[model samples]
Target: NAGVTQTPKFRILKIGQSMTLQCTQDMNHNYMYWYRQDPGMGLKLIYYSVGAGITDKGEVPNGYNVSRSTTEDFPLRLELAAPSQTSVYFCASRPRDNEQFFGPGTRLTVL
Candidate 1:
């Protein structure tokens, strides 16, 4: 089964360009999350959803927003992006807790 998928593999955005990072899982997990990792840094949670229609913000949700409309998809929206938002974004999920599987990642570069 495809655990989680994110695309496009890389992106370049101008100072204010907007984009949506798509995430989907075939595992039917109840929990999904969005996280960003700067170079040589730990992953910081941006948003999480326990189940469909139940989304919540996390540690670093400032420049991002997420929605959980179905058990399979949780997409991240970046509006009016800034240079500070340049980082690798990952989509993850857990059937339980504390142990999550991540997507390959979306490398975003904002200039």
Candidate 2:
């Protein structure tokens, strides 16, 4: 794709389950981010990377992990999914000083 794309548009998980939300982009953006949005709430950043081989935690990184092995992929891993982790996850990318490009979003439900 030319912009950010996320896989598995929807998912259902049980408590303590785990999954990885996949994200890919083709714009060669140097910055990538992972965010989650709960119902009636704003998006919360989970992790981000400036480039491949570099990553950092954001506003809400707990219970989640991320890796940027290349310029085009930024995957979000939920090691032990929780009820509180249920939300719509978004992947975004941007070039330096440019506007962000976002994925369609992945809706996850934890029971």
Candidate 3:
């Protein structure tokens, strides 16, 4: 099973443009998270869901949103893209007492 997967491995968006980054997992994990990695920086949490219908803003959620409607999927939505948002986005999932599994990641460039 695909532990976790993300679509559009790479994307370019103009300033103010919006896009949705898709994430899915096959591990039946109840926890899902979105994180961004900037050059020379560690991953920063953007959003997360503990389970279906329960989502919360993370450390860097100002320009993004997310919803968890099922156990396998959590999509991150960028409302208004900006240069500051250009980074590699990673999706991760974990079951209780298990290590988190991460997606390959989506590289976003805002011009």
Candidate 4:
């Protein structure tokens, strides 16, 4: 089964432009999360959802938003993207905290 999938593996965006990072999972997990990873920094949570119809903002929710309208899809929307938002975005899921699986990652750049 596919664990998690993210689209547009690489992208270059002009400052102020917006895009959506798509994510989907077939694991049937209830916990899904969005995280951003800088060059050498650890993962920083942006948003998460416990299940369909239930969502919460995470540590770095600024400039980003998410919606979980279905059990398998959790897409992240970037509004007015900025240089500060240039980072690798990852979508992950876990049956619990002990086991989390990450997507391939989406590389975004703002110029």
Candidate 5:
């Protein structure tokens, strides 16, 4: 899909606040992906980028924003963090002909 917006597009966070999920990888890779893993479940795609300055939404792009300003950095912005968004986030990078290399992941709790 091109874009997605929740019914209640904006909400003021009560306890949990916004955060920028940082994903780091080699400068040589051209593709990067972001995913979140909940308890006892598999990772769900949040966003991805083909190269610098190019990004697109993945399966679960809600409540998140991503930008690829440079090859070495792809940051996911968690907006109005909600409890549902609490999970361990994984960042993976891969070259055109190589398998993806994922980071340990960042644990985020929106509560």
Candidate 6:
């Protein structure tokens, strides 16, 4: 089974535009997360969901939103994209064991 998959591997957006990054997993995991990594920084969590219909913001969520409607999918929305939002976004999922499986990641550039 595919552990995790992300769509639109690369995107370039003008400032103020909006986009949604898609993530899906066939593992039936109970936890899903969205994270971003800047050019010189480590990955930072943006949002997470413990299960379906439950979602919460993480370290950085100002320019993004997320929803978990099913255990297999977690999509992150960027409203009014900004240059600061330009980063590589990754989606991850894991079961109760706490080992996370990450998606290949979507690289977004806001100019």
* Model 3 clash number: 0
Candidate 3 C-alpha lDDT tens digits along 1-111: 968999989999999999999999999999999999998999999999999999998898999989999999999999899999999999999999779999999999999
Q: What is the lDDT of residue 68 in candidate 6?
A: 86
Worst lDDT run of 10 residues, candidate 2, spans 1-10
| RMSD for each of the candidates | 1.1, 0.9, 0.6, 1.0, 8.8, 0.6
C-alpha lDDT values of all predictions: 0.93, 0.94, 0.95, 0.94, 0.77, 0.95
What RMSD does model 5 have?
8.8
Separate clash counts for every candidate: 0, 0, 0, 0, 0, 0
Off by over 4 Å in 5: 1-16
Which has the better lDDT: candidate 4, or candidate 5? Answer: 4
Residue-by-residue lDDT tens digits, candidate 1, 44-105: 99999999999999999998888888999999999999999999999998897578889999
Query: Which is the leading candidate under lDDT?
Result: 3
**Alpha-carbon TM-score of each model against the true structure:** 0.95, 0.96, 0.98, 0.96, 0.83, 0.98
Q: Which residue runs of candidate 1 sit more than 4 Å off their true CA positions?
A: none
Per-residue lDDT tens digits for candidate 2, residues 16-51, read 999999999999999999999987889999999999
Better of 1 and 6 by TM-score: 6
Compared with the true structure, what per-residue lDDT tens digits does model 6 show for residues 5-111?
99999999999999999999999999999999997899999999999999999999898988888889999999899999999999999998979999999999999
Q: Mind giving the per-residue lDDT tens digits that candidate 5 earns over 1-111?
A: 111111122233444587677766754788999888898889899999999999999999988999999987888887677888877788888889878878767766565
> lDDT of candidate 2?
0.94
Clashes of 1: 0
Worst 10 residues of 6 by lDDT: 63-72
